[model samples]
Target chain A: MARDTAREPVKTGPDYLEVRLGIYRGMVRVRYFEKRAYDLFLQNLVKGTSHLAIGQEAIAAGVAAALRPDDYVFATYRGHAHAMLRGAPMVAVMAELLGRENGLMGGKGGSMHLTYTEGNFMGSYAIVGAHLPIANGAAWSALYRGTDQVAVAFFGDGATNIGAFHEALNLAATWKLPVVFVCENNLYMEYTPIRKVTAVERPAADRASAYGLPPVLVDGNDADMVFETATRAVGLARGGGGPSLIEAVTYRHGGHSRADPGKYRPDAEVAEWLAKDPIPRYKERLLDEGVAAEVLERIEAEAAAEVDQATEQAKAAAPAHPGGLEREVFSDGGATWRR
Target chain B: MTYREAVAAGLAQEMARDPSVVLIGEDVGAAGGVFKATAGLLEKFGARRVKDTPISEQAIIGAAMGAAMTGLRPVAELMFADFVSVCHDLVANQVAKARYMTNGQVSLPLVVRFGNGGGLRFGAQHSQSVESWLMAVPGLKVVVPSTPADVVGLLAAAVRDDDPVMFLEEKALYPTSGEVPEGEHVDELGTARVRRPGKDCSVIALGTMADRALAAAEQLQAEGIDCEVIDLRSLVPLDMTTVAASVAKTGRVFTVEENPRLCGWGAEVASIICEECFYDLDAPVRRITTPHVPLPAADSLEDAAIPSAERVAAAIREGLG
Candidate 1:
């Protein structure tokens, strides 16, 4: 089993307190946005399918807080939280889910492929384990250009068994590229439990030694611990200490997608994870740390209001125009294959 | 210059001109290349630019896509065209659709070069023409160079272009010598070159089949049959204008293909010819391709499987009749 570093006591200081509040606010924003997305999906406002990160907010929030503004982030389909935390406009993200012309990708990407280049959130890949090597490529470019920028790739625990994951890790370790691979071990891969399919108990961390990387596992539910682990990993990568694989053990609150009710999971397991929900746990932590209840309430209210505004704005936007179908396929701004 | 030497020269020319161009693949550094096509590049460019990666095609192509997304213009090589299946997701799904999916948020200015086609009896796994596989995919520029000159010029063009290009080098033609243009040689991507012009029939081919078509055209000329040989340098940016014009003049068309008969690149060309040049064509657009089966290891069987000069001439002559 990977070492549990979630038991470390929270540090106390004015600066630390401020950072903690920011992390908490980020988590709240994600929780509200995801819940709104769920509602939107139910109303048929969200097209296709959406993977919600309702219970897995801390990994995205903590990792985003640890990264620099210019740092690149490559995320998977379940990436609303990652994109929002990296400063992607909430309205644009909502519009993308709604498949609107004013969406992040002009409705071309939809929910699974949200990309805000301005925020350095490179892209959200739909294919499993596809973006890991691409993340290495971004890190390689930074190294080649003599920039201190690092690339971070977010994937699920299921990605550990895929060939691209192993291939990416080996290549990153070999080249010593400035990249951080974070695995949000949300207990399940789609509908099935990851442990039932995987050979090892700790899917990602156990494979670290094969690539000459140290096994670093942390509690995905604790924003403070994830932030600290991410900060160290990001600093090491930026300083040319090579790639780091961090297995963040967490659980998903709902099913895999809008379609799944996730009834395959035992009711007891679901109840247990719901009780340890990161948002309420962190709020309790803040209250216990001598922080005012009004501040926490204000953050929650602000997050809810932001989600509400974004929802309205997305609903008002028009569907993508059919005339622009052949545009932007090439750098020439045309999809013509023949002369 | 030999076709193989032109590969290195084209890479060197681009690397010298553009500081952003970097080469990465398995055994591409100190070991030169498996086919020596990338010889002397490591010595000239140094380790920072010329990198040797592990045997991971997914990582190689993925890294190339990632680097291209950021800033660097990466030229990645998969040892064999057949190996594209190993990293098909990166090629077909990720790299191909990324630009369009992101609504042009990212531009993939990269090249994936691979040894393609069968002649040396490498059998099913190592010997396969994959141009047809990529032709079906969108957002990819497919370049198949027959001669050394086209290899050098087209490669330079592919590197400079701000889109993902699949540079398929016919491995059999690597030893064949041809005159390459000196200093900065860049050819247009979508244009087809008419190697031999005629009035009786239009013989269209790609990569290795282009040379065979030219040979077939020469053979048919002595028998009172004038064949127009059109070499399709780039498949994606297909020069249908040139093809349509040739078909109008000749009134007869035949496609020489190395890929299997089923869903080959020739099928697309045939469909286009029938659609646009149906009235101009005197006969049906005949596609003389390899049989729909895995390439055999035996010399005679492999030779029989792939379309030859005789087969192309016979098909055109029979069609013209």
Candidate 2:
């Protein structure tokens, strides 16, 4: 079909512009959610220091979008974006940050330990690299029960050096498990730059080669690239081609936690990365490909409105109650009444 | 039946009863575990359910916790309790805290079996009684079975429980023969068993030490002093009611354990007895435990480190007098 070049680019495949536009919306939602979380931290509404995934939204958006409802996903402490993208209630996430009765975990687990088991987002682990092995176990359970369900573990660049990461990769490769290990290489492992501690090169795949699975490298800023790569990896895992690794190259725009400024990162490096932020880049791509600019603006405005309402509701909600503190401590009728 | 056979039978029964129950550990499948506690399981359950792993303790326990959370009942084996140190973080933080952390949204229906205690010349690294450390974790239910019947029932109960159970099997008592009741016997975890009836003193013990306490009680019976022997099957819930009743009747109590005397479960038991039934006691409760030293590799030194029946009897005699 012949189309006007300025508005609709010729040869835009079926659903091409629509898909990119949706991804742009997801990235915008994550950015707004993270910005509000940062504000909540400053006001001390958030119990502990919140780790912001400000610049790493595209990875969560792409991977979660690629997943099926039953497919499991385990993310690290920097996991707000992942949960948000998976459609967890924004008000519950906010209430969890404020440690309220209506929070995701009833205020039991705060920012770093959010869990939405019904959504199959098992948790966001506080410990680095610890959740990888659990992801492997979930994959093994799926395989044991003769299901095509796959498990995905989302961890940071620093987790690659830990023992759990190495053992998990080895076990997954050995058992031929259906899992996708995504390393969000955001340049810094918390405050320390990954280059200082890591022995290998930029792509984490270099290390995965030792475990017998070749890793896929993707431009984490571009959601289209990440979505395509993650979909292919998920396909292989479901079809019993064993586990695969994806090294997503990205950068974090915020500090490791609330208090310290990321002074360890050079200003030139910060400015350079800030210029390529995924939210704006993805938005520009969608608009250039003949997607309406009004759609992008509406998505941003809606995300801002939703997040503002959730924040106010969370901050004003009742704090966690002290009654029945020892409930659910152990199962099978343990009778140690602490009253 | 031997304790080893009881464990295998219990696991087999649970795995057959519930398809979600899975066994994962090193050498647990074809090798049938280091102590043969899992013998014939791989043949019955197949490799997927009765799986073997590398020498990765943390992965073994962590994966069990993971599997349990995702709707599988997992029974993981650590060859020795000493190796649990490697999996401490997974047990203490993840498996123990997951249900509470998630506000009851998730339950770890998992059982972690460890071959615990000393008297075997496995050296200091292999021969630690680690109940002291595992007990400090709040959400974990700790159980140590002395007899084969208790082993079978407690193992079955652990598989059924929604939370994590630290099912510590006494390594030295695995080969000891006993009449374990057949056909679906389940032990209520925190119920203490009264092995002997007496009025002079109450001798409370756990795991293999229960046998020693019985032997000590028998020796005291010859000296015209009667002793009631209590076997505590569970540690966390701690069936102190049975203990308090026995102490109230006997008017004297002695707690026995194989772990070190300094900061041990024996002291916790002694403290509980004092707190609950102190007025009923004729004398201060005594704790018979190993001196503060790592279990040595030599047989002579290992014997010296843990309490013998003679030592247990002596402590009971002193308390009764």
DockQ per candidate: 0.89, 0.54
Query: How does residue A131 of candidate 1 score in lDDT?
Result: 98
Q: Candidate 1's C-alpha lDDT?
A: 0.93
Error of 1 at B159 (Å): 0.5
Worst 10 residues of 2 chain A by lDDT: A1-10
Best by DockQ: 1
Per-residue accuracy of model 1 over A1-339 as CA lDDT, tens digit each: 112322232366787788888999999999999999999888888879999999999999888888889999999999998888888999999999998888988999988998988898999999999999999999999999998899999999999999999999999999999899999999999988999999999999999999999999999999988998998888888877889999999999999999999999999999999998998999998899889999999999999999999999888989988877999898999899997
Candidate 2 lDDT over residue span A155-211, tens digit each: 999998888888888889899988999999999888888988999886478887888
For candidate 1, give the lDDT of residue A55.
96
The models' CA-based lDDT, in order, is 0.93, 0.85
Which pairs in model 2 have colliding backbones? none
Q: Which residue pairs in model 1 clash with each other?
A: none
- Residue B294, candidate 2: how far off, in angstroms? 1.4
